[model samples]
Structures are given as structure tokens and as C-alpha cells.
Target: MILNFFDQFCIPNLLGVPLIILALFFPLMTWFTTNRLIQNRYSTVQSSFLIYITKQMMLPINITGHKWANTLITLMLMLMLLNTLGLLPYTFTPTTQLSMNMALAMPAWLMTVLTGLRNQPTASLGHLLPEGTPILLIPMLILIETASLLIRPIALGVRLTANLTAGHLLIQLTSTAVLALMNTMTATAMMTLVVLILLSCLEMAVALIQAYVFVLLLTLYLQENI
Candidate 1:
């Protein structure tokens, strides 16, 4: 029954549609925000008062050039919110699953490759192995480059998944222990709760940090392509 409740609601949400929706929403939001900001740069004084006075695009609206990375804000925000939401009681973190992390990594990996290829046809090889590396080491360099490029998204995914998954799992274990021992004995339940709270705070930071790291790496990828 315990598992049944979890499977019905938390599992579906933790594993399914909500994540997809968030994933889509963040990029779209990022695109609109970035585009609005870009247009604002060329706007007239007759635009919104905040635009005139504060020169800020406002919340849920962000600016960082009109590029594809802005669109990738979707991934960042999704990971962030998902990670954060998991910190709440009774919520499962999807990131805890490697499959979910892989989903995130796969896109980034493909984007990196596509970006490199789009930059130049014949020179696509150069991206895999920088311009001036030695011929004797070219194959090795290729492997290294591939690893470095591929690892960005992999690391991003793992960092988020592990951080969130680990935090939540720890909370779950401690909470279960506390409940089981409530009638028997305990002084460490409070300590566990304190640690859980601290981990929750850490999770929030991880969410934001992961988002920033993901975006920054994406921007770097774009910079390389452009």
C-alpha cells in the first residue's frame, strides 16, 4: 500500500509528464526572455516603464543574448525545479535515476556534435581534435576531445542526479529510521531532521548551481560553434 501510493502519484510525477512539461517550458521561457531582452536593447522609450526605468526584462524573463543557449534554459530550469521540489516531504527525485540523467546528457551531447558540425563541414574534424595537435597523437587527441565534450553533459547530468538523489535518499532513510524507532527510543531523530534540513538547503544551492553550470557550458558550446 505504501508502495502503491508512491507508484500511483509520486512515481508517475517523479518519472513522467511533469518533467517533460518543465523541460519544454524552460527552453521556451528562456527563448522568449532572451528574445525580449534583445529587442529591448533596440526598443524606444515608449516601452514598459520598468524597461525604461529599471532596464530589466523582469522575472521569468531573462537576458543573455539571442542565442540557442538561451533556449537551453529549459534544461537548466527543469533540473533546478525538479531538484528543489524533491526536497519537499514525500516527493521522489527523478534525477536519482541514471536514465533521467542520461536523457539530459543525450541532448547536450547531440547539441555539442551538431553545433560543431554546423560551424564548418570540412573543419568538423578540427573540433574533435584542435587545430595544432600532433599527428602522432591525433587519434589520442580525438579520444580526449570526445571525452571532454561528451563529459560536459554527462557531468552535468550526474551532478544534478547524484546531488538530488543522494540528498533525498538520505532523508528517506533517516525519516524511516526515526519513524520505526519513535516508540522504542531516540535522541538522533532531531539530528537527522537537522541534517535533512541542511541537505535541503544544500539541494537548493545545487539546483541553482547546476542550472548555471549547464547554461555556462551551453554558452561555451555556442561560442565554439559561432
Candidate 2:
């Protein structure tokens, strides 16, 4: 039963062929593109929304970090699409995989850290310990700070994995219960189905929020470094 419950999260396959690669790029396929002098209504709305989000993300970043705006915006849209698309029946979510999340988080996080160290070595190292540390506490504080710095990527990956996993598990469990109860108790099953519907709605919101939070944290990390 447990394995069956988790099977949905497994990388889906068809005739021994992995579908994850297809899933990864499916979101991009749905996007509208145009080269006309004026975009159509849907294209205009999409462009405006993306621009708004890009501007908001860039607002808190330093001028030096502005160059990353396009990269960050692309990531945000990709993540948003992936998370939302995963909620569809029979679809896989790459972000729910620890390995995949780490692959995404580590490079981005490391790049920000490296950029900081390269551009402002003193400031980056200074973050290891406060300026007013006591002589005896210096080593301990540095160790703690260093450990924290090293764990940011892990934290980012785990946060995304845990939240999506929990929500998916909850939805799965509630849905199974609803189905099982329908044979014996119609009214109770109906109530459970309503709860399941609400949970699905909540999950959609969580999908978008988690994606935004992920990008927002990266932006903040970039801000600190650049």
C-alpha cells in the first residue's frame, strides 16, 4: 500500500523509456510565442504578467545583480509551470525529486556564492563571522556560520521536496479514502470528496507559492552576495 501510494512520484516510463525528459520540457511547449508587430491578446497578457514578475524580482536586487534578471525570470516561470503541471492526472513533477531539486538549487546557489566571493572576497568572507565577535567565540561562530552557508543548497532542495511530497501524499490518501468509502457510505464519501476538492485547490496555491518562494530565496542570496 505504501509503495503504491508513492508510485505516483516515481519517474513514469513507457515501454522502458523514461518520460521525465518529456515532462521537463512540456511546460515550455504550452507557452505562446509571436513575432508580429503587435502580439495577440493571450500573448500580450502573458508578456505583461512575466514582465511584472520580472520587475518585482529585480526590485530588491543590487544593480550588479540586475544582469541575472532574465535567468531568474526564466527559472521562476519554469518552476511555476512544473509545479502546476504536476497536479494534473498521470503527470510527473521533477521538482518533487530530491536529486532534481538539488541539481537546480546547487548550481544557482553556488553561482551566487561564487559571484560574491569573486567580486567581493572580503565581504563574502566577512559573512562568516560578525565584526564584534569575542576572541573565545570566534572559532565556534565561524564554524556555525560556515556550516550554515554550506547547507543553503541542501535546505533549498529539501524544502521544495518536502512540501510537494507532503501535499501529494495528503491528496493521495484523501482520494483513496474517498473512493473506498463510496461503497458503504455515500454521504460520508461525498463529504470526503468535497474535502479532496478543497485540498486540490489548496495544493494549486501551494504549487505557485513554493515556486515563488524558491526564486525569492535565490534572489535574496544573490542580493547578499552582489
Candidate 3:
């Protein structure tokens, strides 16, 4: 039973070919276009929103870090699309996998760390020790800080995975309950269906918010380095 519940998170395959690749590919194809002469309402709104988000994200970091603006913005959009798409029936969400999330998190985190080390080595190293540290506690404090620094990427990956996994499980359980009760208890099934609908809406919001948060945290880390 437990394994069945987690099967949803597994990389689904059809005739030995993973669907995750197609899942990612289709979304990217839809998100980009070659048209330059026309603009629709949807495209206009998307452009405006992207511009606003880009400005907000770039506000904290120095001009030196502004170069990262495009990369971060594109990443946030991809994540948002992947997350939103996952809520649909018969779709696989690549972001829900820990390996993928960690792959995204670790490289971003490492880049910021490397940037700091390259641009401001003394300041980056100094982060391990506070200015007014007690002589005896210096070693302990350094170790603790070092541990915390190394754990940032792990925390980022775990946070995204746990939130999405919990939400998906809850939705699945509620939906199963609704299906099971439809024949035996019509009224209860109707109520469960309504709850399921509301839960789906909330999950949609959570999906977008998590994507924004992932990029926002990366920007914050970049701010520290720049």
C-alpha cells in the first residue's frame, strides 16, 4: 500500500521510454515562439509579468550580478510551467523528483558560492566566524557555520520536494476517497468532490509560489555574493 502511494513519484515509462523527457519538451516548445510581428493578450501579459519579476529580482543584487537576471528569470518560468503542468491529469512533473531538484539547487548554490569566493574571498571565508566570537568557541562556531553553509543546497532541494510530495499525496487520497464513496454515499461523495476542487486550486497557487521562492532564494544568495 505504501509503495503504491509513492508510485506516482516514480519516473513513468511507456514501452521503455521515459515520459519525463516528453513532459519537459512539450512545455518548452509551447512557451517559446518565433513570431515577431504579432502580439496577443496572453503574450502581452506574460511579457509584462516577466519584466516586473525580473526588475524585482534584480533590485537587490549589484550591477555585477545583473548578468544573471536572464538565467534566473528563465529558470523561474520553466519551474513554474513544470509545476503547473504537473497538476494536470496524465502528466509527469519532473520537478517533483528529488534528483532533479537537487541538480537544480546544487549548481545554483555552488555558483553563488564560487562567485563569492572569486569576487570576495576574504568576506566569504570570514562568514564562517563572527567578528565578536569568544576565543574558546571559535572552532565550534566555525564548524557549525561551515555545516550550515554546506547544507543550504540540501535544504533547498528537500523543501521543494517535501511540499510538492505532501500536496500531491493529499490530493490523491482525497480523490480516491471521493471515488470510493460515490456509489455508497452520494452526499458524502459530492462533498468530497467539492473539497477536491478547492484543494486543486490551492495546489495551483502553491506550485507557482514554490517556483517563485526557488528563484528568489537564488537571487538572495547571489545578493550576498555580489
Candidate 4:
């Protein structure tokens, strides 16, 4: 039963050819492009949403960090698409994979840390130990701070994975229960179906919220560094 539950998370394959690559690419296919004088309503809405999110993320950072607006915006869009797409039946969620999340987190986190070190080494190192730390506690505090710094990417990745996994699991279990009781308990199954619908809606919100939170934290990290 445990293995069966987890099987859904595994990447699907056809004749030894992994189809997960196509799943990862599927979100990008949703976007539409046009060179006409006027854009479609859906495209216009997408552009506006991107602009709004980009402004919110960049507003807190200094001028030096403004250069990263495009990079951060693009990353957010990719995450939003990937997360939303995963909610579709039979779709694989790349962000649900720890490795993929870590891959996204590590480079972005490292870039911020490196930027801080490159621009102000002393200031960056100063972050390792507080100015008012007691002499005796200095070593311990430095070690703790260093560990915390190194753990940022891991935390980022794990937070995303855990949230999505929990939601997916709950949805699956509820769905299975509804299906199992459908024939035996018509009234109960109808109620369960309604609950499943609500849960699915909630999951949709979570999908978008998690993506936004992930990118927002990254922006905060960048803000501290820049």
C-alpha cells in the first residue's frame, strides 16, 4: 500500500523512455505568442500578473538588485506554471521532487551569497557572528550561524516538497475513499465527492501560494545580500 501510494510520484516511462521530460516541458506549451497589434485577453492577464509580481518582489531590494528582476521574474513564472500544471490529473510535478527543488534553490542561494561576499567581504562575514555576542559564546554562535547559512537551500527545497506532498497525499486518499464507497454508500459517496471537490480547489490555491512563497523567500534572501 505504501509503495502504491508513492508510485504516483515516480516518473512515468514508455518502453524505457522517460516521459517525465515531456511533463516538465508541458507547462511552457500553455503560453501563447502573437505578433498582432493587440494581445489576447488571457495573454494580457498573464503579462499583468507577471508585472505586478515582479514589482512586488523587486520593491524591497536595493538598486543593485534591480538587475536581477528579469531572472527572478522568469524563475517565478516557471515555478508557478510547474506547480499549477501538477494539479492536473496524471501530470508529474517537477517541483515536487527534492532534487529539482534543491537544484533551483542552490544556485540562486549561492549567487546571492557570492554577491554579498564579492561586494563586501567583511560585511558578509560579519553576518556569521553578532556584534554583541559574548566572548565565550562567539565560537558557538559562529558555528551555528554558519550552519544556518548552509542550510538555507535545503530548507527552501524541503519546505516546498513537504507542502506539495502533503496536499497531494490528502487528495489522493480522499479520492480513493470516495471511489471505494461509491457503490456501497451512495449518499456518503456524494458527500465525499463534494469534499474532494473543495479539497481540490484548496489544493489549487496551495499550488500557487507555494510557488509565490518560494520565490518571495528567494527575493528576501537576495535583498539581504544586496
Winning candidate number (lDDT) = 2
Off by over 4 Å in 1: 1-65, 122-124, 184-186
Model 2 lDDT tens row, 1-226: 3448888888777888777666656545655444446768977888899888888888889788899988998898788877876687557777889998999999999999999999999999999999999999999999999999999999999999999989999999999999999999999999999999999999999988899889999999999898
- Model 3 C-alpha lDDT per residue in residues 1-226, reported as the tens digit of each score: 4437677777678888887777777755865753645788877887899999899888888899999998999899888987776686666667788999999999999999999999999999999999999999999999999999999999889888888888888998998899889999999999999999999999999998999899989998888887
lDDT of 1 by residue, 36-115 (tens): 65555444442553233222211222343335533555566566666665555444566667788778777876775686
Error of 4 at 209 (Å): 1.2
Tell me the alpha-carbon RMSD of every candidate.
8.4, 2.1, 2.0, 2.1
Q: Which segments of model 2 are wrong by more than 4 Å?
A: 1-3, 17-38
lDDT-based ranking, best first?
A: 2, 3, 4, 1
- The regions of model 3 sitting more than 4 angstroms off are 1-3, 28-34
Candidate 3: which pairs clash? none
Deviation in angstroms for 100 in model 2? Answer: 0.7
The lDDT of each candidate is: 0.61, 0.88, 0.87, 0.84
Candidates' TM-scores? 0.62, 0.91, 0.92, 0.91
Output the better candidate (2/4) by lDDT.
2
**Prediction 4 global C-alpha lDDT:** 0.84
